[model samples]
Target: MSMDAPTFRVGVVVERRPSKSPWVDHAWRIVAIIPEAIGTEPGHVLGHDGEAVLLYAGARSVEFHRVETGNYRDNLTSGSPGLWVTLALTDEEPGIRLISVTADPAEGESLTEIGDLMVEIAPMPPEIAERLAAFVETHHVERVFTKRKRQ
Candidate 1:
């Protein structure tokens, strides 16, 4: 029940979308993630892990969502569209960082942004949040949840 356990290799990306879809569209890729080196911005380096990624393109930025994580499907299906993003890294691990990017949207997108980004490694009622935490733990990415408001 420790809160700081490492789990998945999480990361984030910034993509731009020309139009808005009724659903959060997986259209773009990771612009960056917390790199494995010092002085590097958290969640800013792309292609750290050799895994496939699915990104959703929005009006201003892109949301990089990983499909490899088993819990992704569950969280993505939940009605809650907003989620938190974090970076997970262990004390001993190096050159290996996990970035936690929620399956939610951000602000300024008018119809997209939803709620506040909650960052905690615990079981949340929403499968997506749990999935996000699991991914962070597995990859050791410390995450920061950003809350969104409805327009």
Candidate 2:
């Protein structure tokens, strides 16, 4: 979608435990699907992680925001796509929490550093990528180059 336009997907949160590696702890995976309508919530949570501390109760959905052209350019320069996923804890309950998906790497990094939370830059599924591209095509407006007048 456009940089300003936010795309949302309703999907179940899947938790994966570290099985093969000792360095890996636990991770929450976003298994999302395109919803028929906007504002639809996921039916339920998928998988379980006893080590993960729930920030909220019940199921959680994700909000994906397209990377703006400026950020995308920066990512290209830095050899990164700037795609990030953030897991935030809520004060309401202690069961599940909402996940925010973004294309801005800086924002995601800040959240993790400042909030002391876990954030991942996992690969987006093909279906989700296609949908995101569609959203960007529909909403993104090309930036026009304007020469500045020297004072």
Worst 10 residues of 2 by lDDT: 52-61
**Candidate 1, residue 46: how far the Cα is off, in Å:** 7.5
Reference-based TM-score of each model: 0.20, 0.47
- Specify the highest-lDDT model's number: 2
- Model 2's alpha-carbon lDDT is 0.48
Instruction: Write model 2 residue lDDT over 58-131, tens digit each, in one string.
Output: 23233444446454444434643434666554443232355665655567677787564657675555555555
User: Which regions of candidate 2 are displaced past 4 Å?
Assistant: 1-6, 16-67, 72-83, 89-96, 134-151
